[model samples]
Target: MAVFSVIKLSELEGAKRIDAEYYDPEYLEVKQKLLKKKFVYFKNLVKEIIHPKEIKREYEEEKQDYLFLLAQNVRPLMFDLSEKKFISEEKAKLMPKNLLEKGDILFVRSGNVGDLTVYTGEPKKIIASSDLLIAKPTFKFSYYLGVFLTTNYGQKILIRGIYSGLQPHIAPSYIKTIPIPILPEEIIRRTEILYLKAQNLLKQSESLYSQAESLLLEELGLKDFKPRYKKTYTAKLSDTFSAYRIDAEYFQPVYEEILSTVSKKHRIEFLKKIFDFRRGIFISTDYYTEEKTSRPYIRIKELTGKTGIDESKIIYIKDNYPIDEANSLQENDIVIAIIGDTIGKTNRIYKELSGGFCSNNTGRLRIKKELNKEIIPEYAEILFQSVIIQSQIEKKKTQTGQPKISDKEIKSILIPILPLSTQQQIASLVQKSHETRKKAKELLEIAKKAIEIAIEKNEKEALDYISKSEEK
Candidate 1:
């Protein structure tokens, strides 16, 4: 179906956009409704907008680090810390403008216009990447404005603000011209309160996940364990004269240190003894689409640590898949990244991700019938993510060309068998963590709906709506 819009010359924007989409009737309708109430320009709502910069960074370990946030970390209503990277404190201090404070809004100026999220986490802890437009809002305006812009009317106005060119981008100069509809002061105050509640819930969620990891490591006696990494380590001539080996990196002592620690605590079992493999099938890039209505294609990068897909980075399969292939992943299927940037990453398919198609670089692991009674999939994913398994992957994976874990090496990979009760306890905490995060998102949603109702109907009705939503 084709859609057309006719714009009158007198009604055209001063910048003179004749693009058919610029005159979208829906946008025109929203423009009228927004003007019906008292409105102010978006620029008047913020303190200052910080543009992106190219910052030189030095990566560091998790404990001695400040988080480095990429554009993908800025989710719609929250930041997804499932996958994380870090920078040294020395580098973090040098570029303070890049560091995000709580209540600051992280806006995407290009690529994904109108997409932004308020930071509800700790102040000055996370540093955003160069792709984000970090805006420090006045008072609690962050919560009110952030939710409002994501509303249906707000999104359309942002679309109209896009300066179309070879690569469409939104400029701060253009944003200054965007209108923001104002609601009651009390309504804004309540929205701010809701965001704070959401933030606290998210903090609780992260703490639960950490507790789960700590429990697993504690049970395995790897708690408070730090493997030594020497500047220069030596190996005997006989040890270096293996059939295929001349590489120095292959003989790193850190690998041995980790192995020795785990072996002393528990007997290690070869993964091949307990699991069967289901490798994903290859599909051409021609089948990929940005049209999200199509079936999503899950690659290794799409695997979030929370056992879910990163929808912002996810792509859809435009064409019908081959009829004979059993490429579809089912709920709770444990998947692992076997190649490229995310090699060694493992997660289970959540209920929402059941029907998604997996890419060739990823492989699914199913516990053999004999071993299924002993191991839980959730527990397996947690074990795979730990340094116990990751260290082995680092020692075995090819590093010369494309980084990968070989099939032969994977079969021989080590696994620790923990007590069944301990595994269930760890898995239960992880499930609770994921649930708490959802509740946080739900609160943000109530704010969004309230904003919509206030604009469409009246503030009295909207306040009643919030009151009723709270009662429920």
Candidate 2:
């Protein structure tokens, strides 16, 4: 069967867009349904939609007076404040309008178009990169608007408006023309409630992780410790020969400081003593397929800790594709990026991601059964993310064209050993953080589904779905 769409001459003239995607039948149907109910241009609902002015600035890592958010900081329906770059207050003053406030909606305009997130009133003063389009909604319930934009129907319309050539792009003018349905007040209220609840849960998750980090630092007596850099350092010729060819970065004072601090506070043990490193499977590109299956092939990009594992982004292989059972992920396994810019980044496998195929560029750290009683996987994961182990991993990384750490180097990385009781306390906090984040995601999905149901069916049906989902 062939699908056809008939468009009127006047409609084409009105849109001034000759691209077939701009007039896709599915988008037209969604538009018609929205128009059947109360609808208004997106520009009318928002006070203004604008992009930030480009700032000529440099990152001030040590003196981080002002925080800056890049496109990577904006995840779906959430803002990832971790690993943020900062600038001095003097530099931030140059562009005051870029400062974000509560209830403001952010949309990605370039590279990863159509990605959206709302600033949920955290970090009183922060600025966003120029790649983000900031929409300041005049309506009280902006969360409802944010939820709608992230849904399948909303994403399709936004994506269809994209102009692809050198790069995929969406302009503010195109975003202004998108239609927004004026949903029932009750439905909007329910969405706002759920959205706020999710935000609260996410905050709890952040706080729990912070508590766990604090415990680790306090235990190691590094709560107020700072690395001091010296202009000159001495290293013996024999030492350099034994460690192989030397780079100035490999002998940084900060690396030694981190190592010395950990050794002083706790008994240090090599990673091989507690966990065995296993490399992920490598499948040739010729074997790749679009066939949908229960198995997901996870790449480095999909290993984001903040978003967990995005099932939507995973590429599937054919059902008959050979899978190495030994390389398959298991619950509580720690997946680390052993190659490229993502080196040292880690994501602990949860129940939902078990049985997925890991990418070749990654490595898994499975707890040694004999030493499992001494080390907790959750605690080890947090340690890997901490400054102590990360600095060591950074020093050991070999940079050719792309940076990579060998499995031998990974096994040789030292880990600080804390008391089992202390490990349990930290593990419990981290586990709760993951659970809270899961709850936050569940609530956010309910809100998105409710908006979709309301648009495709009726307001009453959407409300019923929300009620039933909440019961579950």
Candidate 3:
């Protein structure tokens, strides 16, 4: 017989395993109940459409722009397709691909696999890249299928089968075989409604972000700005000026084009006086503690996936902890992720932080005392997320085999110095957008909770809770 030691709840530390082992039969029972209550469905691949077996070895030399369902581009799917460059027909034809239809569930097969998204907008022509799987669900329940695929039930089974080693991957055949929860008809209907609202909210968020960018560009009279180009075909050029010579990835002219537009349009002198750009207080892991308090510390991992700082997920330090210079995150201070993959991304603290401590990966900027200044932290936050700044950072970044942007590049970034009125106007719109986004997030949380409750109880109870919350 197996033996186990029991320990009190006090012995457990922040979800970590302690030396004192304990067995919980209730935990397994709950898990089994949830599993038993769950239903499983599979993707229906039966169709009359021709499935291409032969991988085209060569594509034509002519370049034709088409919608690509690549994983990187799918997260923020609202792209100006006309403005984006495309692969030459020769390069495009070599990969295994399929036509992407509206409402088709897009799943990443390799490289940070299991990133799920649904194609909503109607596109004339779209091709699924080799790394993507286009789950063409029947029109009758395509939306419902997409929702199920992204939910906890679908994701749990889908991710469990990944035979990951050096790199994680989920083959299309394996993904298609995974069981999907066959939710009740009434529950599915309610889910579809919530899902559609969520979709609308997502589109609104994207639209608002675009509006914010356009307002910034228009206020500075860069609406029709076009970047300059030297040689379009510099692939064969030899590097005589530098020690390193490689592919055209490093010398991509898009950066120069983005930089020139900002420099020529915005007044550089005015920007330097408006806001004080400061690096964050460098912190180490040694400062962290198991004890929780009123104060919350912000980390890079917490801010990466979302648009702003999530206060709920903030880690708190002990109240009596020493007040180091790095531990202070004041109100209106802009936080930017300064290390690893998300270097240029920026977020602002909207409310006063209770014992605000910032992580080393986050750069904090304290706004100048002048509240009515031409450039505020909010304005700076929006500008930092603009294409102009993104392009500039990309150009100056010294790729250590991979793209890596540094804090030096972030601080040196130039901003458009516009009239105080224009800056405030843009800030106001961004604020409203943020508010709407917050509500949308609440709705998404409700959706998740409703699904969980529905699995344990019934659809009526979950819907009642959602309705009450909305009413409040």
Candidate 4:
């Protein structure tokens, strides 16, 4: 079956877009419905839309002079502040217009096109990378517009304007022409309230994780410690020969500093002692499929910590791919990235991801029943994410074309054994963090759904839906 749309010659001339995608029937239907309701052009709703001037990669410095926001920093519907890059104040002064203000909408103009999020994170001074488009809306309308753009209706229209090629791109000019429905004041207020609540929860989640990390460092007497990086270090020839490594980075004083600190604080044990480890099965690409199947194939990118698994991003394999219980994920299992730049990145398998299939490039750690009394899975996960174990993992990584750490190397990394009471305390904080994040995600979903309802039905119906959802 084929879908067709009839466009007037004058309209076609005005658009100047002869591509078939521009006239897609589904896109036209959505546009017509939105136009039927009270609406205004997207450009009118914003104070300004601007993209950053290209800054040479060499200009970026490690010093925390000013924060730079890149396309990769903006994930779908959320801001990832895990990685930080900086530029000098002198350079930032040269580009005054690129500065990001709180609540400014950061939109990606290229690669992972249409990925947008509100800049609700900390630090007053932030700048956008060249590939991002900054949309500064007036007053409280930022949250409302952000939620609207993330909805299915908004995504369809925004994506429709994209020009596909080697790399799909959405020009700022296209974004300016998008139609935004002028929803009722009550609906906008409700949406803003939900969005604000979600943002607050996200902040609480960050605070709780910070507390957990602080507790771990405090327990190890490393709360105020900083590793000294030396230009040169000496090591015994016999030690190098025994380890079969001669790389300078392998002998970095910081690695030794971290290890020595942990060794002096508490008794250290290899990860293998507390858990049984296994690698995921290697299924060839031929077996992968986008169609629905029995299980979701978990990849390294899907190992998002605490945010839980994103069901929408999960791709499927053929039902007859011969999956077995051994290859499937289980609750409380820890999946660690064993290859690429994210080597050592770990995420605990939650109930929602149970029974999913893991990719071959990952390793799974399950607590040994007998060792449960000494170490809990949740506490171990927190330890894995901490800088102490991460430094060790970095030391053991092979620096071939792509970095990788063997499962054996991962199992050999030392884990400090804390008292059961302390473990429980840290584990409790991590669990609370996960819960708060989950609630935040739920509120975002409600906000998105409410917009969809308002557009598809009416304001009254959407308000009723929100009321019923809150009551439940």
Candidate 5:
């Protein structure tokens, strides 16, 4: 079946687009439903759009406290805070146009265009990178735009405006033409509260995970240890031959330094000794399905560390697709990205992710039944994310072609064996963080759904839905 839209010649002028993709049926259908209610043009709500100038860390200062928000940090309704970078307070002061405010909405103008996130004014002073298109909300209703852009229908409008190129992107000019459904004052306030509540939950999640990482470092007697790389270094020939590598990166002195620090307090064990690993099976795209109810096909991108699985990015496969039993995910099983730029990243599976099939690009690790008493699943997740294990992974990953760490290479990586009691404590914090993050996502869904209903149905119905959903 084919879907088509017929438009008059004059109608094309309003969209300022001549491509067939711009006239997609999904875009037309969403526009019709949005026009059913009073709406505001996206351009009308914003004071102005800004693209920040590239800022560099010109001076190395004693303090680099201010966060330098990059395109990677800005996601739809959230950010990836697993890793971070900072600029000095002096550097931040030099870029006033790039400074983020509570009411500002940051849009990814290039790469994954249309993805956006709102600033809640955390840390007070922060700067946006050049890739993001910063929109300052005139009415301070940033959440309103954030919620709309995240919804199923809202995405279609943004997708329609995307320009095709070597790198696909959207301009601030195109954003001005997108329609944002006008909501009642009561509902607007409700949406704002819900978004802020979600952000707060995310903050709590980060704090808990940070505590877990700190506990591990404290136990390792590395509470104050920071590895500094030496540009001029030497390695023994026998050491390289034993490790089966000739690369200078594998011979970095920092790797031995970190390992020596860990060996001081706890015995170290190869990852293979504690957990059995299985690479996920390949499932062809022919078996893929758009139905959300189908079995979710977990890809490498879903291995979001602290935030748990990114549910929005998850794709689905046929209900009865044939897959290997070893590829099956179980609660507490660990899924790791063995390929690409995120080569060493991992995510601990929860009950919600159980029974799904993982992609070939990932590997599944389940603790040995006999070793269950030796290590907790939560602690294992925290340990891998910490520098103790990440350094090992960094050394083991293949540098040629597309970078990757094979399952055999992963199994070869060594990890510290913290005491069972200490492991349990760190595990507890990681578990709590995941649970908090889940609740925040739920609240965001309610807000997005309510807005969608307001456009498709009526304000009264949407209000009732919100009231009922909150009670549950």
Candidate 6:
């Protein structure tokens, strides 16, 4: 206290006379208690996994390893572009090393930072971009670490440590130093249970997509479809064509090869029978409305992978708007993205979107009404999403800073036609898969909400129901 100052104030140059006490005993005690609650520990407890092979010091040409890559968002992505041989000297410089191994936990290091994903397949021989940290735990804490990182406490530590600025960045070292409180064994077990449920739901969605693709392939009688273009071979081009002067990527021979393959199998030509397939009209920002009594406008941002349509982000239209002016989405109509890297992505309007309006970027497809087509829109959606179709899109993708698929390209796309009965069977499986996916999403929401409530109120009061059940 100032009244009982042990040291003279005149000795301190910056010191000023104060009537108030220098310190409060009660306040100091409370501060000490809070400081004790701070959990700080060394990061070396968690281990990092590097590529198994060491980089070559010398090279016949500049050598590279499996590409080192990282996911940029909540969704992790891998680029599989190994087919084309003969990398350019300039292009080769940008190539990465460090191929990813299955079951390895991927951690983002920069940009849209701090997302995690566990790899499962043999994407071996591929590289990871420098913006990632692959963490492998010494203890059985990997699963718990994942759950905690996604939890409020984990996110709190992550967010608090972030160096705030424009294009906010969190250093990998900072993320590694984050304190993960030791959770109860019961809580850990429950977290694992929730994790597994979510994993199973994802797997089911993937399997459903696979089944639908197989059905389409069999229906088209091209069950064993393979394109003529070989990744190793250098494609020949005629000098006569001016377009040939451009880069080899512009001439997506793979797209044509696929069209040729389907043409051989189908009894009827899909191109001839179809009425129209083209990109939608792009509307300027001035035309958009903030609110309306009628339909909501859809955008590519609204799209969720495998989740289909989401209406929460939609914009409203005016009631006085003319039907012709309104961007109406009809029943069973297919919506496909036309611009940017996500081009060729497709979704079908089902019961949920019985009547809605999509964005200009979303291409609309209405099969000829007279076709009386029993062809499930879901089935067609599955076909477009198949690896076979996606491979072609990648091969043909015109990269202008960013990769994109042309409207002309999707218009000429081909699919195999199956018996109506077989199509129906596959559609049934898709419907069931959708139901499971929806339920899985709901359960995940409940689990997250429970965790939020637990953080606000102590675990005992928040999870009292679960605790009582465990006692029984």
Measured with C-alpha atoms, the lDDT of residue 265 in candidate 2 is 71
Candidate 2 vs candidate 4: the lDDT winner is 2
lDDT of 3: 0.59
TM-score for every candidate vs. truth? 0.80, 0.90, 0.70, 0.88, 0.94, 0.61
Candidate 6 lDDT: 0.54
Superposed model 4: Cα runs more than 4 Å off? 1-29, 57-65, 86-88, 120-123, 138-140, 161-168, 281-294, 306-312, 316-321
* Candidate 1 colliding pairs: none
Across 332-434, the per-residue lDDT of candidate 3 in tens digits comes to 7777776667666667776746357677666676666874455665677787677676666666566575555555555566666666778888887777767
lDDT of 3 at 405: 52
lDDT of 6 by residue, 1-472 (tens): 1333344566332453232222233323332332344233426546664422332322222235333343332342222121211223333344433445554556655544545555544434544545556665564645555655655555455554445456555665556656555545565556556555666776676567557657767766567866555454354556326333356554556656665666676543443255355455554455567664455556675555455654434566555545563357777677777667676676677665645566767777767677657467666666656655666566556677766666666655554566678778777777776777666555444444444445445555536634443354
- lDDT string, candidate 1, 1-472, tens digits: 5777777787887745777777888888888899888898777878888885657545554645688877656667677676677887888888889888877888777666777888866735787877788878774577888888877787788778787667667777666667788888988888778777887898888888888889988987789997877779787888767515556677888887887877887878998987877777677887777776436677876776653455546777775655334677777777889998778877777777666677889887778888877988778878888888888888888886788877778888888888788889998998888789778777877888888999999998888887888788
- How do the residues 1-472 of candidate 2 rate in per-residue lDDT, one tens digit apiece? 5677788888994766887777889888877776787888889888999799887557655647778878767777877665778887877888888888888999987877877988877876788879788999998888888888888878877887899878888999988888888889999999989999998998899889889989988897777888776678877788789888487777777888878877887999888988878988887766666665666677887777644555545777666777778888888888888998978888788777787777899998899889889988779878888888888888999989999998888998988899999999999999999899889989999999998898888999999999999999
Instruction: Report, for every candidate in turn, its global Cα lDDT versus the true structure.
Output: 0.78, 0.83, 0.59, 0.82, 0.83, 0.54
Model 5 scores a C-alpha lDDT of 0.83
TM-score, predicted candidate 3 vs. hidden true structure: 0.70
Error of 3 at 471 (Å): 3.4
Clashes of each: 0, 0, 2, 0, 0, 9
Which ranges of candidate 2 are over 4 A from the true structure? 1-37, 63-65, 163-168, 282-293, 310-312
Q: So what's the TM-score on candidate 2? A: 0.90
